[model samples]
Target: MGPSVAKLASHDRVWQSIRQSAAAMVAEEPILASLVHASVLNQLHFEDALNYILAQCLGTAEAPAILLHQSFDELTTAHPDVGAAARADLAAVCERDPACRSPLEALLFFKGYHAIQTYRLAHALLNKGRRPLALHLQNRMALTFGVDINPAARLGRGIMIDHGTGVVIGETAVVEDGVSILQGVTLGGTGKDEGDRHPKIRRGVMIGAGACILGNIEIGARAKIGAGSVVLQNIPPGCTAAGVPARIIGRCANTEPARDMDQGFDDVEA
Candidate 1:
């Protein structure tokens, strides 16, 4: 059919599958029945359930859960693309992460998913000139999920931040679509120099855990960054880099390393 119709069909399928998974969870582990129902089964729309979950997770004594729930609902209703990007992100996790068996798991359990969706909302707010509120969201996400992504950062759709703890993305960093970033990864600047001082990650790149990619470098498309590497300069497309001061170690076996989710640091040639 048409694009809108196809999108609706896809959205329907994703929501239905997540609902079935949540139901199965309730039946199998009766202990989590309340949580499953509240998080997934109770809501009519997928976005509503997501908003409720985010509100509950981000709420505190000062800002009540009910108010935050209303606020998030308004935000997503005003800007539906945030929810759409969230669905794409959920699909990315399901397709790339072996541990993510169902969309229900990514929706209700994964903090990486939670952090990304929250950043999307905060980014939208930042664009709308709600700086204080956006910063509040950024602070909450950092404290609660241990994932600190600046709201000003430009992140494209279909991103999967696996095991999201200790991940820090700088304010000027730009992460393109279909990128997979592991835990403890830092996309920070090298020095105190202001204005556009962060890495620009291209599409389908996979950055391993604890990889510190510092400075205003261009990480080319489908690049594979080895774990714990200290990258200082630009990397060409389809290449792998790894070391204390990471150099071009080799070329990747897989064309789409992010989608492939391969963590192998092989030796071939750039």
Candidate 2:
């Protein structure tokens, strides 16, 4: 009875799912799974949950998971020095959250983790010339997480998304280096045009929550987008945009505030 009790107590469905999924993942892409596993292990000591997420993306309800090792490896190889920045940013987030005890926990529990992972995987597919597959997965990630970023969307170093809900960065949305964005922001399209209908957010811009910058607008470098604003045109550098039909309201003093643009701070009110 004591042994049986211990066995039952040790059982965990979520962990079991992770293990099964990971083993199955070995078949699809052993090298890529190894690469992902290495990354996860380097950042997380016990990363079953993270593995579960990767598996979920690669798995089906009834079938074994497809690991896509080559795809994973290809994506990581595309950004050779990116892991350092990603780790640093993730560390910063963990420090800000009192509940986060380690980078491992942050990697496992944070929505940013999920969003970035989806983006990374999708980006890998995009790089592989799998446009339809990449776009399809990107859309699926958006529907699942409420944060939509295209794999083809060029994101530079130190990009952060805070409280990442309802954030839509359209196809061809070019976000340069050191940009931060809050939640509920849409760098979206204007109409049914086939190409180049989205905004181009330049480097070091801080976009606030619930702000909608529409059409083929170009938001200049270091510009600030205030919460809940709707912009239909271009915004110059060192400016702030606010209100419905968002307009230039103020000057941007600092690009880095309490929360980085990517930290989802824009969702504070909404």
Candidate 3:
């Protein structure tokens, strides 16, 4: 007797959701709708399609994922040594996040994903002396994504921003390697004055949800900020700061989960 073959369930539900989401996104933000359509069509897997759709709901560039992948590949080919670590950092994050269906998912759904990719493109433009265009795109990204990150900000690799809504990274902000941040966290300026007015976020730091770290203050490496904290001063390394006027409350040797990280998404498991 021949063995029975299992029938694959219809993917109509998934496709329908994708189409509806794409249409809604277009209705909301027509300028980037076509890009979202392209991203949805490009995905080969159902999970990837879902991820991309969810990203649209959360606000992200549908085009940057593809472009950044290509750019990263080119970078790896051209300067293998310099690009290796950054690429590895990206890959490592993807590996750790099982929800990441593909490298493209990592690019689209990860907040740090968009930020890092944009930073690379912006940095390239900065190097090429195309500052205006870079800044223009950066602003566009801020408006489109609801996360204002200046292209000129110097950010190191493996940075993650959970939820990412209301996150503002200023022009003079300097974020070092392995930092993770949550939604409503601001690395911003005190005023409109020209000098350095942004915060310097050191390596391996984690900023909790709705935590506002203002001015040119320094957040030492491996520091952690608790949810809803308003930091107006410097935070030493290995400390966790919380509350309105943030104060050191605990110690963190690793990434601390913020409130935004615990926020739910509506999706059934495959």
lDDT of each: 0.91, 0.63, 0.61
TM-score of each: 0.94, 0.68, 0.63
User: 97-167, model 2: which lDDT tens digit per residue?
Assistant: 45555554455446655675667667767877888867766776776677888888767655666677988
Candidate 3: TM-score?
Answer: 0.63
Over 106-222, each residue of candidate 1 has an lDDT whose tens digit, in order, gives 999999999999899899889999899889989999998999999999999999999899999999999999999999999999999999999999999999999999999999999
1-270, model 3: which lDDT tens digit per residue? Answer: 012211111244433444445556667878976676666545543334433433343333644545444443444355443343345445545544556555544544565555555555566666667787567557656765667788778877666665567888888899887777767888888778788889998877767678788899999877777778889999887676777798766665344322123322111111
Least well predicted 10-residue stretch by lDDT in candidate 1 = 1-10
Ranking by lDDT: 1, 2, 3
- Which candidate, 1 or 3, has the higher TM-score? 1
Candidate maximizing TM-score? 1
Greater-TM-score candidate between 2 and 3: 2
lDDT of 2: 0.63
Query: For model 3, where is the 10-residue window of minimal lDDT?
Result: 1-10
User: Could you give me the TM-score of model 1 versus the true structure?
Assistant: 0.94
